[model samples]
Target: MSDVFERYERQYCELSSNLSRKCTAAAALNGEQKKQMISIVKTGIDEAESLIRKMDLEARSLQPNVKAVLLAKLREYKSDLNNVKTEVKRLSSGGNYLSARDDLLESGMADTLTASNDQKARLMMSTERLNHTGDRIKESRKTMLETEELGVSILQDLHQQRQSLLHAHNTLHGVDDNIGRSKRILTSMSRRMNRNKWIIGFIIAILIIAIALILYFKLK
Candidate 1:
């Protein structure tokens, strides 16, 4: 258990340390900075997934609800990171100058100042959202760690609950399969019985007609 905890801790530390470096590098305006940010976000996601996997393995009984919440948070971070990348690309493409043209006009710069102001506002908003996303990621990580700690206390309860749920699910699945099979069998049996009934009626009608014909010929 200590080994598992140590591994998780080491991965978390490595991820956090790298994140700090990436953030510093991203403060600069260069292609390298953008690349670093992308790499960092990817690494963060990988580390989070690794942590979750480790928790699952060690716990032997992780709460599905908790896992679901953590996964949702991770997805939110991924979306936010993608949005940040998009904003960076737009600014780098000179779209910012086009967007703040109104602000530029007030400064006798025709459209440039207005466009710059609008772009700045957008950039500020994007930055805020990015920061918020970072905070959320941090909170999620903390929650995950806390859950791991609590797992020791709740292992027996969680194990029993998980087993009960699994058994219920399996039983329901089996019942559904049996019901389907029974329906098919009944349908096939009905068809066969109906066909045989028709065949028997036809044979009886033919035999009666033959007897009538013989009686008519004998009377003649």
Candidate 2:
């Protein structure tokens, strides 16, 4: 367990540093390199987060001292994951700027040098705004899809839970019926036993009276 936690911690630390460096160098990165770096960081972040979550679960059953250490490691990994996520977001947002810059520089328009500062500034601003808007629209669509999937999953889980509860309720109801039948049977048997006891007592009383009368006649 300790080894596992240590490994995850080391991996997270390494990924965090790599992502930070990548973000710092993002302005110099070409489109392909940026995409590759983003992919690496995203994958590493997911792995690190998963490892920490596993560590959390394993720590629950460990001794106090070991559990504390594991928990601390988990926190460190989580922090690193957050840092990596921030770097990724930075890179993603900068991607549009990089693309627009590349487009403008590669256009080789002869008038670009003669263009006024105000005109260039306006063009740059318009390009960036359009890119950012497009990115936001894509993100919104992604979020909507994810939310719909989550809702479906929740409904399925609720349906399963309801089925389980209904089954349990039916089982308890059957048990109650069995108990009622047993109680009725017991009451009927008890009444029959009491009636039989009374009949036996009356027969014994009559037998005793007859014997007493015969004995008294012989003596007189």
Candidate 3:
């Protein structure tokens, strides 16, 4: 990163020095020389602008304090470059100063820079979209994991309930068996009590009859 900044700074310094020299000499030159000077100025300004852009990009990756210093430096470079461009325009202000070719070249350089900036903008937008998509996918994955855990918990509860129901059913079956056994025992006891009662009544009536016959004999 520092290397990139150094390269841009170096280029910016060279372009600035070269433009100032050419602009200083531009007033004394003849028509062709002045045109050449203007041409050099145009090219230097373009290169300087390019370097400033590179430096600006490098600044973006820097620490905030360092980035601020670099940005301030870049702004100064831009201002100087703009001044050079204005000087060139002043020198070439007359009618029919620049040829159609120079105009075409300048326009082409501008178009290229604009296209590059647009491409970078598009790339940034695409990266942001990809980030959003990744975030959503992560959230969806988390939701799916939570849902899976919930499902497992529900299944576990169902299994526990089923076990409890099976245990209850077994207990009820045992209780039913005990109740049936108790009913049978009670029925047997009732039958035995009824038989004993009948036997006792028969024995009592026989005693009474025997006693009456003895009384009649005594009377006779």
Clashing pairs in 3: none
lDDT of 1 by residue, 1-220 (tens): 3456457646655665565555545546445456556566556756655664554445444357655654454455445445544444443333333333333345453477776776677667756666687689779978986886576458767768889999999999999999999999999999999999999999999999999999999999
Ten contiguous residues with the weakest lDDT in model 3 = 95-104
Off by over 4 Å in 3: 1-115, 211-220
Model 3 over residues 107-166: C-alpha lDDT tens digits? Answer: 433578885666556556655665687589669968975875576567657766887999
How high is the CA lDDT of each candidate model? 0.62, 0.72, 0.74
Residue pairs with backbone atoms closer than 3 Å in model 1 (clashes): 100-114, 100-115, 101-111, 101-114, 101-115, 102-114, 103-113, 103-114, 104-113, 104-114
Best by TM-score: 2
Question: What C-alpha lDDT does candidate 2 achieve relative to the native structure?
Answer: 0.72
- Per-candidate TM equals 0.36, 0.49, 0.43
> Superposing every Cα of model 2 onto the true structure, what RMSD results?
7.6
Per-residue CA lDDT of model 2 for 1-220, tens digit only, reads 5666666566666766776776667646768887787777677666665656556655644678988877786787677667667767777767766666666566565575554454567567967787788689779958975875576567657766887999999999999999999999999999999999898988898889988999999898
RMSD of each: 17.6, 7.6, 27.1
